[model samples]
Target: MASPHRKGSNIEGILDVKRDKVTVSPLGLDITWGGDSRYWRIDARYVELIQVCWLEVNGSVEMKHLEKSTKYKLEFKIRMKPDAFGWNDSPVYIMAMPGKKAKCIWASVDLSRIKKSEQESSLIPPRLEFTTPGPESFHEDDRMSFGLFEIWKGRWKGGLVIEGVIISRA
Candidate 1:
């Protein structure tokens, strides 16, 4: 569901890794997700974690779709439900690599910092910044693979809503 939309004078490129397009570990059995009427207007689907000890959500975007030589940031748009648990001390890592041969870059963020509210509200998630390779260094088929992970904790966690991953100019 990634698309380029027009900005005032320039096109602000964006890549949206929607729930359907993301690869979720332990899908269906422990995690349930799909489109809902509430998000119909924005054309967004949501992934909810029922219960899981290992967590990993991954997605990627093609470099050709982005403006060359420009810096971009990637973020996972997520929210924690009121009854969410097991994230008190768990630190999730956000990772990204410009291309298959590139070294991976990652940053850790504490999801427990997000305040749980009665309403479904979005939180300012952690971001990983990367610069698109210049034309001479870029390849048409190159891709930027990214993911959110909390696999080592091995503690049961639930009530997490994954809206999607957003990649935009930094």
Candidate 2:
């Protein structure tokens, strides 16, 4: 595509998730008028389909009940830019997957003070594969899900821009 939006364009994009549908574009991802990476970087991942904030409030999609008694395979992929930002440190990507208990899926490469370029891959997102018990197993009648993503720079931080998709099948 046209690379979405140019950096430092003072624009914000969003991801709209709907039933049987998911769309992702670009966002400002930073507080600066120009999307500049000073300390923080970018990270993107996908998770199981759950209650989308926008669609839920508008009643655009029916709340499908997930049988927690069954088993589900949740997959996510994450990536980050090593340097381009004005950061002197290399940050790490810490991933978390929620289940019966909160679980740490994997940690990205530790750049912390490691000499490297800004365009390298500081965080190497490993293949995160996990399984979950169906909704029927839960005591509640509501939909069951897990938080898919969280992006940040270890020391100095700035705007975090991320992109990805979540897929679920019965």
Candidate 1: residue pairs that collide = none
What is model 2's C-alpha RMSD?
11.4
lDDT of 2 at 153: 32
Quote the lDDT for 131 in model 1: 78
Question: Which portions of model 1 show Cα errors greater than 4 Å?
Answer: 1-44
**Leading candidate by TM-score:** 1
Tens digits of lDDT, candidate 1, 1-170? 62221111111233323432322221211111222222111222556666666676666666666677877777776778898889989998888888877779888888788878545656335557887777787886887777778889889887777766667766
**Which has the greatest lDDT?**
1
What's the lDDT of the predicted structure labeled candidate 1?
0.62
- Candidate 2 lDDT by residue in tens digits, 40-149: 23333211111111100000111132233433323222223343232334434334333434244544443234334323322123333433344543444232232222
